[model samples]
Target: MSVAPVLEKCRAEGRAALIGYLPVGFPTVEGSIAAMRVLVDSGVDIIEIGVPYSDPVMDGPVIQDAAVRALAVGVRLSDIFTAAEAVAGAGAGALVMTYWNPVLRYGVERFATDLAAAGGAGLITPDLIPDEAGDWIAAADRHDLDKVFLVAPSSTPERLEAVTAQCRGFVYATAVMGVTGARASVGEAAGALVSRTREHTDLPVCVGLGVSDGDQAAEVGRFADGVIVGSALVRCLTEAATPAEGLTALGVLARDLAAGVGRGRS
Candidate 1:
């Protein structure tokens, strides 16, 4: 019921939980749902569903394309909740990630209410600044939803303290300076970033952005609480000729990444 319990279970098992990201309505609502089911079945610990918006400043080319396709199909906040509900009904936990504009457009209280009813464990508004998050943060708290925030290598001690204080669910530590995608290596900067965040908060720190393979996931798991993979998995789905093929590819990647993180923790 709570993300804390799921995270704790993974920690107790000595396994680094896999958090997979996908933009809602990439191929279509149906295709996204199918992919989500496959990821859950393949042992993903948590799902980060991207709510498509017109302007996605932080997203890279891969996620941006998916969001644009989703919007072209008329994907809205309501549709995102519907998809999340389906995944939750299938016994999977999820976190909805979106920019703040969509949340404001939907009305904070109403959006939070829908998300909670849909069985979402948390919300991640990457563009939500800590100083300006009171309204939605209050709404999320009222609905008992975890409000997750991001911290970067550039965050100062003052900024880290502020983010840590306002953050719940888990802290997302960006592994690179740019948008999301896979890279050849996790890099020393990411390791240093996680270490700095650890000094500011005891909460779980999940490293994301540019993590493409099990080896990278394993490497990140060595320093962070969890590992997040996005573009590589999305690319796999995008290349699939059919939904079934896409699901198959996603499942294989999830399994391999899970196994990689498991080995690292062991």
Candidate 2:
């Protein structure tokens, strides 16, 4: 994935990449795929196809509710490959954000191979820190897959160095300490965290969690390489009464956030 080439493109164009997150099989596997196409067409720089996990510890209530609905329908691992293929075709790099246990159960080597064949850019293991990710690291490398690791604001300088050193695409910087959700305003600590993380590596660091609107995207985009929005987009689909409405809302949010990425601090 060349360290997430889509992100590099956005940087060349003079903007922070806009990364959108949607859990696969949300409304339905097909419905989620359709919504993703809308997001890609509307200028989403990257797509995070969330693999629905029973115990999504890092997710907030909105995402947890959506995942529960998907799981109820028996949405399996294969469904994610299908979603990834479709989303990748829409011109946005598709990466799976999943918990460690599911990938472990599916077999790391097999999972990485299948994901590469499905045109996936990589994996984002939210619960699996780099220090304990030896097997995943090897598997991803063998398959030429990008492995994105998360770095929290609380991480020490040494911890940040270790995490960034292992990260392939971009470092997922969790803006807040808690689980993911929309917030009114981004905190000052987020910028400081980005600053602290930059001291460790030159790789792109993307800020996620608690970002909901364009203004907040612009705020984070000013200092980070990318802005990741998840709960807000999921809420859009969850609130929609029909697929048409959902897709429409998704496009609207995508465009708004895309615009925000280019409007970062002067």
| Best candidate, TM-score | 2
- In candidate 2 the C-alpha lDDT for residue 258 amounts to 84
Q: How close is candidate 2 to the true structure, as a TM-score?
A: 0.98
Query: Which portions of model 2 show Cα errors greater than 4 Å?
Result: none
Deviation from native of the Cα of residue 31 in model 1, angstroms:
1.2
Clash pairs (backbone) in predicted model 2: none
Model 1 TM-score, all chains together: 0.97
Best by lDDT: 2
By summed lDDT, which 10 consecutive residues of candidate 1 come out lowest? 1-10
Report lDDT (CA) for all predictions: 0.85, 0.90
Q: Cα deviation in Å at residue 88, candidate 2?
A: 1.4
Q: Give one digit per residue, the lDDT tens place, for model 2 in 1-266.
A: 54378888888888899999999998999999998888889888788999999999998999999999999978898898999899888888898999999999999999999999999989999999988999999999998999999999899999999999999999999998899999987798788889999999888999999999888988899999999999999999999998789889888988889888889855
What C-alpha lDDT does candidate 2 achieve relative to the native structure? 0.90
Clashes of each: 0, 0
